[model samples]
Target: MALRVLLVHQSFPSQLIAVLEALERRDDVELAGIGMNPYARRGLRYRQYSPVPVAQTGDIVIDDLASKATLAAAAAAAARALSYDGFVPDVIVAHPGWGEALYLKDLFPRAKLVCYCEYYYLRSGGEVNFDPEFPPAPPEVLHRMRARNAITLASLEDADVCVAPTPWQKSTFPAMLHPKIEVFHEGVEVPPADNRATDRTASGGPSVSFVARHLEPHRGFHTFMRAVPRLLRADPSIQVSVIGSDRGGYGAPPSDGRTWKSVLLEELNGSIDETRVRFLGSVDRRRYLDALRHSDVHVYLTYPFVLSWSALETMGASKAMVVSDTAPVRDYFTDECAAVIDFFDSRALATRILSLLRNAKIRTSLGGHAREAFHDYELTRDHGRAAWERLVTSF
Candidate 1:
């Protein structure tokens, strides 16, 4: 009989998709999942759950606690419904950031629980106070941040193994949990046809590229935008493409009621050459890859937080990258492999990108080295699959 497996994530398999794909090819394992939607992954059996309605009157702390409690309850109920169908997993893997995994252990006591620890909230040396431009989060907000870690802590205490996607992310957890947590990159997808022949710079003058899930301050959209005017002024022929949705992903939304994109545009005023700069907002995967494949140089910046999938995608596509020297990013790339720069220094960013664009030989060498490093250092699906199988089968 095949081993039954259950995967859970509040949103979906953002980090586990590669592992799920690998599992799909296996004849010895059966897969199922519980998420906000059942349609996230095809073929796998899935259960959908939604937060139960709650009474409105409460403080931020109370409301936050209630919301998470509701999600945990819903997930637990879904697992029970799955159990009613006589489906009991041998192993359970979940990303516990959103409290979805808090109650899974209760539903499947015999199943080995593995929790994906994406991030741990910190009052200092983290995203909360990393940017001086934004007002420091208040004491109450900081307290709430600590309180928010309750679900993660609970999950860690319950898990058979804790997997963190990066070393820096793992470091954020309490020292007691370090022994239980291990580092993983969630792996990058390198398609079979991924080759330098796809470079479109043949017809265009250095297509400078930037990509992220959303265009927000946390991911350094403002910083990248600030550098664009100088970059455009330095090389009028180069065209820049900024990809992703104009929305906030982390921290609080802009207090001024304007998005980070609007704020940066207002700061740039008429300085940016609009015709040369393109905001290709949230294109499909194929289009995004085409943009990266054609990119002469890719720029990625972020505060001290979770690494963006876009960064890995760019590196996998073998594009010369000018990345921010943030804590999370340091684990994947170094100065030798990528043009690592301080996130705040727009001038340095512009200069580095300009140099990369002008020197094709250097671009090819840097990009080649970066791609090789990713493959050699266990950042692909092959390595991820091996590590995941080891952990899943250990119990």
Candidate 2:
């Protein structure tokens, strides 16, 4: 008989989509969820909420009271309505970040629980990257938030297993939780981009591309903009294409009428040559794949972040990448495999871009090695299926 499974997460499709997608494919496991709706159109239905800026801070605190109330109400409605034809799961796998699991523990006490552990708060310098403009800290606020995360930690104790994406995340939990933790990567299928060929240079210039949501300061948009003039001066044959959404809306609406993207573009006005830079706002999947495949080099920069799907996508596509030498990235790729540069140093970033543009042989070599590494360490669908089987068998 198939095992019935319930998955809980406040934010569903962001990181948990891979596991959900894998579980949905199985014939032996029943999957259901109590997660945030990514495409919810109505405000009356539970809307997505984020306390910190998206993509800016990884360690975020969702308002626990609101989340608990939402989950409890949903559970009550599910029980009264006999949702899913009175189906009760035997096991539960949830990402316990947003305190949605608090009510779930009571709702499904008999089911074996499994939690997805993303990160734990620490006091180290790398813990907080505060912005002076819209400051996220005074230490006290973080302390309160950490206390709220404790609710999540407590909920995980009820879990029979913990799924983690990286060693960095697995190590964050207590040693007792370690015994139950399993390491996995939420992987992406490499879209068919390797077959398509495109012009490497646009109008006698090297074609470079950047893929990220247009959030300021975090994804290193400002830093990349700073490096552009230097890069253009060094090699006149270079053009850049940035791909992302232009809407100013974040976790919620901005009180001010301007988005960070518009602000940055306005700030860099005449300094940037419109002919050399193109802002292709929110391209379709095919266009995104084309952008990655056609580029001579892919640039990624972040301040002490866990791995991004875009970074892995670039690797999967075998595009040469110039990545930031932060802890999370350095943990995986050694200096020999990728072009590493310090996040704060624009000169170093510009220099690396220039070097990669001038040498096609070195670019090809790095791209080859990166694809090999992706197959070895990053692909997760098969591994995730096996892990799900083990978790179900134990029950």
Task: Choose the strongest candidate by TM-score.
Answer: 1
- Alpha-carbon TM-score of each model against the true structure: 0.95, 0.82
What does candidate 2's lDDT look like per residue over 328-367, in tens digits? 6765665665799887677888888888888888887887
In model 1, the runs with Cα more than 4 Å from the true position are 40-43, 191-203
Candidate 2 stretches greater than 4 Å from native: 38-84, 125-127, 130-136, 174-176, 193-204, 246-257, 266-269
Give the alpha carbon lDDT tens digit for every residue of 1-395 in model 1: 88888888877777888668778778888898888865655568888988889986557767777888898899888888888987799999998887888988887888888989889998777899899888888877877777689877998899988898878999999999999998876687774334453355544566888898889888888889999998888876788888988876776767877777888888899887777788889899888887787777889999999888778767776778899999989988998779999999988999999888878777877888888888877888777887887778667
The lDDT, on a scale of 0 to 1, for candidate 1 is 0.83
Q: Estimate the lDDT of model 2.
A: 0.66
Q: How far is candidate 1 from the true structure (C-alpha RMSD, Å)?
A: 1.9
